[model samples]
Target: MQSLLEQLFAGITTKSAEETERIARAFAMLVPVDTTLAFHGDLGAGKTTFIRGLARAWDIVEPVTSPTFNLYTLYEGSRQLVHLDAYRLDSGADLDSLMIDDFIRSPWCMAIEWPERIADSLPEETWHLYLGINDQQTHTIRLRL
Candidate 1:
């Protein structure tokens, strides 16, 4: 699918941390159960927070954090959800090091963070979620298809 970045809603969350998770869970309703989401945002911009909400909404019981430590994390929720942090990837070669191509082709839906780090490896049909932060306290998530 084409990369789409459109403002669906605009609001301010004074308590960004807690509020962001609620927004993330709500996002779960926007796409198909088997759909993949590639999250694009800056550091501490609420990417993980949103994923936490996603997991919560999907009935993921375990904790969800930035998989930068593990490269990727999988949750066996009502639906399988794959979370990938591509920050360390510099090229397709690096992405291949993780052997994620097969996983991408699997039945699970994958959510990737820092997609800019692996720009070349993304499929033409991947969905992108662009996030913007202002004043280091406010964040905005835009859903792009």
Candidate 2:
């Protein structure tokens, strides 16, 4: 059988939020701590749902929600999980002003939504994932490594 990452790279279609979260949970097992994930998707594409799975993998008990209005939210579990939303930002400098790095602890993973808004602020090694809604209303997620 192919690795979860391999299957994700090939693209996976999720028919529901649970399926999307399951895929993300599997993908989280393959990711290293202190990683950065850039999520690209239109509204209602399941980006936050996927991150909720990641949080679950980390044993986070708190509810996971998009940080759209707050810009970022940090959750503590076995490791730190930082959720960032860059939809309102016009440039990377705006991201820099948030002082996000100061809040990050070691062994952390940062998942960013609307990452295109802060492309220049992201590390070169950031893993990119694209989620899209198909005509059938299912969501497809693909990794771009």
Candidate 3:
């Protein structure tokens, strides 16, 4: 069977941060509580922007920001959001120190940035999203199930 990721993001592009967020919000409606997203992209490629849209769709009132300095940030509402940034993490051990499993096993949904930094630690079925910048400064978003 075709996977959800493959169905949702085979080829999608957005012209602005707002558009990206709108698309992300639309997709967020289909996510389950256990869903985990692995986001891959360069800086300013609209990863966080898409996340902001997700938070809005999830009805989270708090702001969404890159967790680079804090490592991870959790937002709570109807359902919890565990935002993780692995940019500074060096290994799976580093990820373990964050007690990532606790979040993964919880009712909360997770969205991880720079997931390549801890690829070994990701859940087997984690959904993958890739964001790229085009010549027109738009974002091209792809997904892998």
Candidate 4:
């Protein structure tokens, strides 16, 4: 049998935002307390939606939104959740200027959207997920293991 991570990454397609969230909730349970998740996808590919699911699993009560403008947002609950959007970042150095580490607490997870913009800044163990939208409007998510 495949490991839990393998099963989750075995190619999942979600027809709705709710389904995507469900998958994220399941994923949140499997990851370590201190980890980073890098989300890769095009516009309207449900990257934020998947992160919303992760927030739900962590019992975060605040709204989870894309930090395209502010660059990042932090939510505190049973565990800390930091959402980062690097679409506008010029380089990994831009990421370093944010001083995100100062805001992070223990047992926290950081979810990065548009991580490619700051690829060099990501930790070696960061988990990467790719999301895509099909012609039928369904969303596909797969792990880059």
Most accurate candidate by TM-score: 2
**Backbone collisions counted per model:** 2, 0, 0, 0
Q: Which candidate do you rate higher for TM-score, 2 or 4?
A: 2
For lDDT, the strongest prediction is 2
Residues 41-123, candidate 2, lDDT per residue (tens digit)? Answer: 99889999999999999899898988857878899988799999888766545556878778788899999999998888788
Alpha carbon lDDT of each predicted model: 0.72, 0.88, 0.81, 0.86
Candidate numbers, best lDDT first, in rank order: 2, 4, 3, 1
**Worst ten in a row by lDDT for model 1:** 1-10
Provide TM-scores for the models. 0.79, 0.93, 0.87, 0.91
Backbone clashes (count) for model 4: 0
Clashing pairs in 1: 1-125, 4-144
Looking at model 3, how many pairs of residues clash? 0
lDDT of 3 by residue, 31-138 (tens): 777788999999888889988888888899787989867888888766678898888876654456788676554556789989899888788888888999995557
Mark the 10 consecutive residues where model 4 has the least summed lDDT: 88-97
**Per-residue lDDT of model 4, residues 8-71, tens digit only:** 6787888999989988898899988889999999989999999999999999978888886787
Error of 1 at 65 (Å): 0.9
After superposition, the stretches of candidate 3 with alpha carbons farther than 4 Å from their true spots are 1-7, 92-94, 103-106
What ranges in model 1 sit over 4 Å off?
Answer: 1-15, 94-97, 101-107
